[model samples]
Target chain A: MLSIKDLKVNIEDKMILKGINLDVKPGEVHAIMGPNGSGKSTLGNVIAGKEDYEITGGSMEYLGEDLSELDVDERAQKGVFLSFQYPVEIPGVSMSNFLKQILNTSRKVRGLEELNPMETLKFLREKVNMIGMNEQMLKRSLNDGFSGGEKKRNEILQMAVLEPKLAILDETDSGLDIDALKVVAEGVNALRDGERSFVVITHYQRLLNYIVPDYVHVLHEGRIVKSGDKSLALELEEKGYDWIKDELAATV
Target chain B: MQQTVIDINKEAYQRFDALFGSFEASLNGQKSNPFHQIRQSAFEKLNTLQFPTLRHEDWKYTSVQRILKHKYVLEDTSMTISSLPEVAKMPDVDAIRLVFVNGVYQSHLSDNLNQVEGLSAFSVEDAMNHEVYNKVLSSRLTSEVDENTNPFFQLNTAFSRSGMFINVDKNVVIEKPIQIVHISQSGDSPKLSAPLFVFNVEQSAVLNVVESYISTETNSENPVLNTSHCFYNLAKQAKCNTYKLQKLSDDHYLIHDIKADQDRDSVFTSFTADLGGAIIRNNINAIHGDENILTNLYGVLLGLGTQHVDNQTLIDHAKPHCQSNEWYKCILDDRARGVFNGKVMVRQDAQKINAFQQNNALILSDTARMDAKPQLEIFADDVRCSHGATIGQIDEDAVFYLRSRGLSRRDAMLMLQLAFLQEVTDFIEHNGIRDFMVNNIVSSFEKIV
Candidate 1:
């Protein structure tokens, strides 16, 4: 579903992501874990075409097309979703309106008819219910004064509504409590169909227990040093990230 | 700079002298009327005070030199309101429509005046004959204004002939709104019109007044200048809401002044929407008399092309426990310019006063400019007064968020700009009026890139 070859990224003359390579097939759930400042979130942002980072030397192909050629919105229209580490708070725009615009835009881009107001409302209600969010929350301003957990749930609700082909969950479990984590995981797990791919990025192994991943990769210093199965996350949590760092230092 | 200043003042005086001669000739036997003294004083004041220059504090950001240079004939010809464009009428809302053509009242175009009990609507000439006119006019006229402060208001006071006089009796609530429409028609000649309006709300009365300004047959070379003045007097426990919508042609100039006085427990609310004009300036001032007064001033200015819009507001809290809130927003695109100067004053004896003022502007183009000045003066110790002003472009992150949701870049920018304006437009209490204003705002966005 996605391919990256020798991905090299930089921001303001400082290299963030060195030469790195990754590949994912259809219906595969890949988990990327790393400590702070390990460039885990940068990979998600670059895949979503955030425009701030400069791809010094790299090639990202999504569904056999060059991803760098498309803008952020174009990428979104083409079934690419990035659940932001911190979702932006847009004042004066209701969540329902925001969701409807995105869904209709994506549908139009995919050669589908746009939904009317009533139909859109119904669709939004179902997706909102699936995410276990209050109906009142959808009517409020888009994340203007929402709690951290509510923002995460809203992001999941958007992901469910859009039904993106590739979803990148960047730190979606950072600020959530146990209950919120369960709800968010349940929401994500419900959307896991046979054709959709997800890249879950986190700092801990707690979220893997809920939405178990098909593969686990440890990112250190912008490079994937190790790749394993879901059990690797439990082992890394029992030990610490320093063990991997010490081993890399000894190997270098 | 000095040469241009001297030339502007000289031409202004020459034109005013010529216009005054024609004005006096039209008065005929009414020269001996009681208002004649007031007009004479105002005329003398006009001659003594030169037109405002950029050196003046209030006129620092705006210049009236171009408007003063035109040779404007006083438009006294009366035309039927039906001759005006259909856009002049707001038909969706149930209102008592009073139409004025070239600053003169058109009785044929007005609705039935007897529909609302205890509500009196009349032209200045007809109201002058009534006994209550003198009392109402003398109660608040020229109480808070002078020639030194606003020369255009002085000009309106000096030459206003056919104006509107509306009064609501005590304990009466007018169910329908009263709309006063001023339509200017200048045919191949630069025209000038001065229209004054006086509104009196008796004790415990409730009323809403809407003033709309529009023009027909506006010529670029022969521009029309409309200098309008309005006075609103609210008695004890009375509530009044005034809405002014200025949508003139691009070649026309408008100078609007509104003065309001509130007694004990009276509430005054004003909404000013400036959409189109070459140069539009709105001066709003409110003064509290007794205790427990509430005042709200909301304004929205949208400028395109080379249009210039200026809004200056002042709220004086003289009584104790009075509250005043003000919010003004502006959207400028192309080479347009906007200015906002809001001032809140809490007097020495006005203890426990709460006053808040905010002005925000969004510049859509690199050439567009905005100047916002929010000032607060608190002389009382037990007062809570705050003022804020922000001049910025649209938020990039917010725009990106909308774009990420599949909106085109243009639609995203427009959505954010409309949201910025909704903060002020949402204060409209009438649903029909609010929707009409929102539609106007949406259409105005189409004119920009």
Candidate 2:
């Protein structure tokens, strides 16, 4: 569903991501674990077609289209979702109105009939219920003045509503409590159809316990140094990223 | 500095002088009555207070050269209209409508003043004969001449014979808003309409007024210079909210001035929405007459194409324990220009006063310009006053955030701008008027994208 080969990226004049290669087929879940400044979020943003970085070399592809050619909205219209690490406050735009716009637009782009307000409300209410958000939340500004957990829940709610093909989860568990984590994980797990894919980026392994990954990749200093399965996440939890770094140093 | 003897735009000033000369000449060389004295006094004052220039500190950003170059007929009487224009009517508004076409009152199109209880309305020329009404109008007129100090104010006063006088009795609340529609239709050449409106809300009375300035000639080439001066006098414990919307031909000019006075324990609020006109200048002033008064002034100016909208507001806290709040926002697109100068004055004796003023603008195009100047002059040691101005482009982060959710870039921008404007438009206290204005505001922003 997604492929990246030798993707070297620079933000300013400074290089951030050296060479990187990744591939995800349908229904596969991949967890990218790394410490701070490991370019994990940068990879997520680049995949989502954020226009800040310079792709000096290499190519990123999604569904046979060059990722860089598509705008942020075009990629989104094609079912690529990036759950932000810090959700922005969309002031004055209400939550329900915003969601209805998203649902209708996404549906229209997919050659589906746009939902009427009533149908849109019904569809949104169902998903909003799945995330356990109150109906009152639909009236407030989009994630504005919301708690950290509510923002994450809102992102997850948007992902469920959009029903994207490839969803990049950027530190979705950073500020969430264990209960909120379970709710978020459950929300993601519900959308885990056989055709959908996820690349969960995180700094810790706590979230992996709820949303178990099919594969785990340890990104160290702009490079994915280690790749393993679910037990690898468990191993990293018991030890640490330094455990992998030491092993890499010995191997070198 | 050496005084250059060739110091004025003499040609432009002479044209107005010639117009006034013809107006007086047509009077058959007979100038009688106190009202004519008022007009004559204002005419003389207008020469001294000629049109403001760029050198004037208050008129720095905006030049009156366009107004000066255009020739106006002083007042247009050639309009023989049968029906009111559709744009003057607000959807679902049950108002006591008063229609004035080319500054001439349309009796057939207006509500009968005698039928409404606790309400008195008359033409300004007729009001001069009524003893009590004359006092109410002159008190404000005399003070404006002494203190307001605006050239447009003087110019409008010279032609102040054109408007209406509305007075709500003591302890009475007007059940519905009084809608005053000024429809500008061009005459033979270019024309001008300067109507003076005075509204008196007596002690403990409540009044709601919605004023609309619209042009019947939509996109016509012959532009009109329409000037208006409205005085709102709120007696002790009175409440008044006056909302104005100016939508005219893009080549037209509108200079509006509003002076409001709040007595002890009274409340006054004013909202203005400028959607059209090549050059629109709004001068709004509110002063506290006694302590414990509250004044709130809010506006939203939307400029598209080459439209220029300027709002200059002043709130004077002359008494202690009074509060004033001013919030104005502008959205400028294309090569349009917007200027906001909101000044708040707290006197030394006005202890414990609270004043807050903010002006924000969203400039869409790179060539579009916005100048926001907020002035707060506070002398009281115990007063609280904070004023700020912010001019910025649309928040790209918010735009991208919306666009990434599958919205087109245009839709995202329109939504963000509407949301930005909603913060101020939502403060309209009346629900029906607010909804209508907000809907109009939405449609206007949609056209921008």
Model 2 docking tier (incorrect/acceptable/medium/high): medium
Worst 10-residue stretch by lDDT in candidate 2 chain A?
A: A88-97
True contacts kept of each: 0.46, 0.70
Which residue pairs does candidate 2 place in steric collision? none
lDDT of 2 by residue, B1-449 (tens): 74232234566667777887787776563356556677777778877876777778899989877666666676544455799888888887888998887677787898886578899987666777788898877666666776656878877777654567888999999988999898877756677778888888999999989999888775345678888998888999999999998888687889998988889999999999998888999999898989999999999988999899999999988999999889999999999999999888888999999899999999898989999898888888998898888999888888778877878888899888888888898899789899878877876776775
The lDDT per prediction is 0.86, 0.86
Which predicted model would earn the best DockQ?
Answer: 2
Worst lDDT 10-window in candidate 2 chain B = B2-11
- Measured by TM-score, how close is model 1 to the native structure? 0.94
Error of 2 at A34 (Å): 1.7
lDDT (0-100) at residue B208 of candidate 1? 87
State how far residue B435 of model 1 sits from its true place (Å).
Answer: 1.9
Q: Tell me the TM-score of candidate 1's A chain.
A: 0.99
Scoring model 1 with DockQ, what do you get? Answer: 0.54
